[model samples]
Target: MNHFKQTVALKDVKCFALHGYYPEEQLTGNHFIVDLETEFSPIGFDDELGQTVNYEDLNSIILEEMKITQKLLETVLKNIISKVIRLYPFVEKIDVSIKKLNPPMPGQIGHSFVKLTYTPTN
Candidate 1:
């Protein structure tokens, strides 16, 4: 029997965090939006929580990681992926994107975003 994969997504998670290269940006903090997607193989169809990843847990993970200050969005994405993989080992693939709202720049600009996709070898 072939087991089908399931996907769980959490999008537009709003957060206020101190993450930036500029010292003033870090001190003032900024609005951020996070999106996460996870793909995993289900063990069964018995309507059990253990069979799939919980979106609430994913939200919590994002919120928790956002609290820790980081200079780069790449670091933030990596941290989130690591935590997710650790908590849900069954997750084979993870896609994460983080957007920094109203970034500090010379000209008027919108948010800047970084996306990362991770696939565990094991």
Candidate 2:
């Protein structure tokens, strides 16, 4: 029997962080939503924690990265992806998206976001 690929996802993870180009934006902080998906080789029918990526670990990484101040969402996304890759070297692919809520702008703009997909080269 052929086993399909496996994926673990952490979706709609909410966070409040101070990340922006402007100093005031960092000082004041803002709301953010994070979404992540990680794909790895299939782990057959074994029900073991070590067999699959842990969602809690992913959440912790997201929260930890969010606390750091960065001028660009792209930077934050990269940082998160790098950390995850470091922890799970077996990870084959990663998809991440970060949304900044209620951005400071003259006109009405709900949010701005950065989304990235990464595949490790071996």
lDDT of each: 0.93, 0.93
* Candidate 2 C-alpha lDDT tens digits along 20-112: 999999999999999999999866568888888899999999999999999999999999999999988888999999989999988888889
- In model 1, the worst 10-residue window by lDDT is 101-110
Model 1, backbone clash pairs (residues 3+ apart or across chains), number = 0
Per-residue lDDT of model 1, residues 13-64, tens digit only = 9999999988898899999999999998777789998888999999999999
Write down the TM-score for model 1: 0.94
